[model samples]
Target: MLTPEFSITQDDDFIFICIKIAAIRFSAANLEMLVDENLFIFHLSPYYLRLRFTQHLVDDERSNAEFKSQDETIRIRIPKATKGEFFDDLDLPTKLLARKGDILGADAVKAPSKSNAGPLIQEIDTPGENGNLEQAGEDFNWEISQTPMPPSDATRLLTSKYGFDDNYSSVIGVSIANGNDINELDDPEKSNAEDRVQERLRKENLKFDPEYYVSEYMTAKYGNEDDIQINGIKSLLKFTPPLVKKFLKWYKQADDKEAVMSVEFTEVEQQQMQKNLPKKTYLVDDVKKLYITMLSLLFAYMYEQVENEGVHNTESAWTIGKLAPQLSFLDQQVITESAASELSVIKAIVLTGIRRSLSYPLHRNFDLSIKVWNYVYYTLRGGKRLVIQALLDLHEVFRFHDVYYVYNTVLISDLCAWFIIAGNENIIRSLAIELKKELDQVTKKDIDFDCVCGIDESSGEVSWENMNIEEMEILSEQEYLQQSGRPA
Candidate 1:
């Protein structure tokens, strides 16, 4: 077997390395590159290529890796440690290869024991072979298969593998992974600076103040990046039946709170259109508290996705604080680039989560979703030119789900119109018109003609084909109230 051999060259600042690889067999996951201070270990599965430099090196964190499978080589452009020659000649003190060619579990590296036998094909035999195996007749040990582990030991082993550590703090309703400040939550004296944000949710008197809710989200900062929490959110998005049920329960409660709060505000007669557009207790309240807590936990991750673009404190970037108010400073074209792919992923998850949260009966998830939308709206609010961008993104996210029932029948009424009244009407109206064209096409196909005819025989209600069903359902609450001769 011919092991892949690479050539190395160095310039004033960077050391360029290239290797001849089997374009057919080589793949991205097949390669691993690790850099110690001066040594570079390149493991292409069973193939090992090591290079050591005399000069101490900066970490490869900033170095760029390029793979040209078509060219049958990988070029890793590494920054040199010194101003001159990076290596004496890419021939260093030690050159090593793996004794056991297994790449996955091969953490130990020992010199090859003068083996004429080459290459790796490895596996493990856990249970003894049975009738299916060729060796079962004489070589296999049947007793090994029959050996059962003790239930306690089995349970302990399973727990240890999963990294579960149950402790006393968990017993008293305090969680280690709770993600809240345990010190602040535990000691009321320490929490006196704020009233612990009153996360305990109740059915009565919902707290829907937008400013306070925004503050809640900003404060519950998840790290700029997280491997674990983001994965948990991704799991929930995989159409998990239980997650859907749980979110619906919280959303319905939030909806009820919105309904009740709307009524309360109705009685008081708030003047602004923005005030009428569904306000609510922060999602952190009650069951929403759990959902929003998860959302907050992921805010930093989403922020990091944008941050991964190497945004400095000076360079303008999108953040949760500005999401409700504005579109991203990074343009749509820029967002499609590699550095901004994470931003796009974040948007996809956000859009899907919101769409799933809404578009369900027995739940009012719009308020929670709108709080999320507020970020974009806030971004737009910061600059009027961004109105078109926000409108386009709104269309894109809604189009992503393609739930015309929600967009035509729900969003046009309250959500997008609220955007119009907030600032620029022309840009939003343009989106509404474009969306209306698309809605027209979808309405042609998805029209429920039987519903118009009152097909439900059990209800025994007559219907008219001439009824403006879509218009009525899509009417704003204020419009309905005005038409019915109720208070604004």
Candidate 2:
């Protein structure tokens, strides 16, 4: 029997199951439903559906089943054994379809002992129904002679957990084993310049206040309550429907086989990137977790691009680089040759994405940021190739302007490592099937960045004394607090 498409939803009392049986007209007599404790059996001729639930359900007087002819749907409402009992994991349909043996932690079927068991087959003489007994004992050549099929792209991707392919050995792998000391060191002048750059970047990071940025943007946009504006704010801050459609269209075009497949890095750029790749190998216990971590950084980087209106400059790139370490605990992890679990890396990367795209972008509208992040997270489900293509496309956009090395060098290098390691696999698909049963598992409620990133939201409070007389009168502190919904 074929399993029909179905949906399950519940509140406090009744669990509603909507099963869609397209193009088939069925009456109440043709439909059959059996609810035995946790198991639900629905049979309608060719269609059969069996669902096992954690919570007990009963078909009492309150329970009802109806056939909606207009939509060709069968709606079954079963009352919970215990009324007002909130059922957990309803959103995860996979969990609800768990077998009895899976939930009970034991095999549902027990094999009978050999002593009590008997073979039903009597003899081989019963097999010759065509009167050709000679063929019964003859060996049948079931193995046909054929050329071995080549491994698929997906299969090839699983070759290395870290995506260290033969093609990327010179770029990703070290030239010599234990060659840290033997490697050429930078000149004193170059070292000094690097130090100066680091110092300047540190100062910039110290100066950046997430709250202040949001407050300033808010004051400028909505300082006067009489002239409050939200018309084109979505195009700027949020990922609207039009933006999503455009992004998806670009994604599909880039993913096409006919399209240019490579990122097309120059020989000089390749050498520079090779020099920057991590020299020492670091072990990741959970490969999927590491993949997700890499994806978060990519998402954050793209999000910044959207925020900058597709313009990539030195300033924004610098901000992203500094903010990456600040937002993520990747800086805190002890980087040694020894392998470490990917759990911390995963958490850090997720934290970084949340902080960068959602937390810091829209300071005043927490809900709006949350809503936008939802789009960002969901859009990432298209797979790793989509992201790589999008990054390549975004790089082209950046190249039109005075492109910054920090964006490619610092941010893209890390992304490249992760992408190369797991390039062959569909990360979004694996994330859903292996890591998380549902993509929506990472929700807005998971936006706990301040505690993780070590940011004191109240630390960089705008001082009233520093403001000019005209500026102070235009937007009062009380009004700002009221608009921002922040405590004084």
Candidate 3:
């Protein structure tokens, strides 16, 4: 008897077939008393056999009635070999499990439990061949290799992962080592160079003459006062009651006993006698002399300031205006012009004197004195109308000629022209034109007026054209006598 849960199979070598038997039927123990009971079974038709197999395996059922209907059977029983191969060919988990257990296990176990259980083989279908799979693996590796490394942890990871000691030193050790010499690297020579430069600057700043600088600054801003004191004639000459009394005391001590006792001596004399003699005379003389000296000094000082201090144009003009009053007073005292005819010549002489005096070391303090003298001289000599008026004061004076000579002699003509261009163009142009004409006329003329005068021989006048024998003889004798008596 076969249990329901168990399957039985049989093979027929004649048909080369394998079959499963679900249940086997057998007759019960003997109907008649016999030596042994014999089992009797009915023979199964081929169709019924097939039907039974279909019911049990293909239809997934085991029934005797279904087994009889082989003609109605829609299912076919697949061979074990075919089923095993189908499962092994699948890539699904169930197929893989069947192949691993049924095929490989069967080989290891050496089992023949199922007939026709040959080696389980499979044909697997894939989108690509094995070559494509290898290529894909290579591509994946390349992609990973090409990927950019993260910056944040690259340094740390490079040394830690790759055994790169240089990277490790750069990342960590560099920072620690750099701290000691960072300042030196920032500005290596700064401290020493700064000290040297600062020391030089300090010495330079201290080199200037502070007092002289201050005095110049003050004078340029406020103008000079020494001129006022020196040239203040009216102030000095004014007689106060105290001064008169002092003068009287001075007179009394002058050893004028008779004059002091005599009633005939006027009040002036009495007052003079009452004054302190030495002190009054000294003060009077000192004040006069001091004022003159101071005036000269101031002129020289102003001149120096203009020339050396680079004063020009408007500044020069302003300086001139400030100095003019003192200069006028000095000019008036030095220059003595009484007649109109003498005016031009006296002016020339006076200007020359002023220029000469200012050039001396004693009067060198008068700034721009030389420049001013030169400007006035050439401008006037150019025959400039305005200059003539400016110098002559309507009538040519000794002062005008003096000024002209000084200017013409001392000034460079080009410099004078530049100054004239600024403020005196009309006069300068006219003068230049007139001077040019005069020069042209003088240059073109060949006749000598002095020679013409000498040629007019009459009325006891000697003739230059033909000298008389007596005159020629006298002139020769005089020349010989003069030459023979010479110092040499």
lDDT for each of the candidates? 0.31, 0.44, 0.25
Between candidates 1 and 2, name the one with more favorable lDDT.
2
lDDT of 1 by residue, 1-488 (tens): 33455666677777777766764577787778877776677778666666555455666565877878678788887887666754542421111221122111212223223232121101111112221112211221111111223556644342211000111012212221343221113422222111222211110012122223222232222223464254233222222222123333443455332111111112112222122222211111122111122222222222322323322231112222122111111011112223232433223224323322222111212333333333322222122223322332333332333222122122222232322222222222222222222222332122111223345588976663432223323334445458769785
- For model 2, state the Cα shift of residue 51 in Å: 49
C-alpha positional error of residue 388 in candidate 1 after TM-score superposition, expressed in Å = 29
TM-score of candidate 3 on Cα atoms, chains taken together: 0.15
| Tens-digit per-residue lDDT, 391-435, candidate 3 | 222111111332222211211121122121222322232222222
RMSD in Å for all candidates: 26.9, 25.0, 63.5
Show model 2 residue runs off by greater than 4 Å: 1-232, 238-243, 246-290, 311-316, 326-348, 357-365, 394-422, 432-488
* Best-performing candidate as measured by TM-score: 2
Off by over 4 Å in 1: 1-352, 355-488
| TM-score list, all predictions | 0.19, 0.36, 0.15
Q: Rank the candidates by TM-score, best first.
A: 2, 1, 3
Candidate with better lDDT, 1 vs 3: 1
Model 2 C-alpha lDDT per residue in residues 1-488, reported as the tens digit of each score: 76676777887889998888887768778889899998899999889877778789998888798888899898999999998987753433333444554444312223333353332111211211211112211222211122222456454333321221111212112312322121121221122212322433333334334445446446545466532453334455544433345544654566342121223333333333233333222233334433443455445555555556556564444334333432122222211112233333343344444444433443324344334444444344444444544544433332333333323333344444444333432234333122221222454344332221244468955322222222432355667777779875
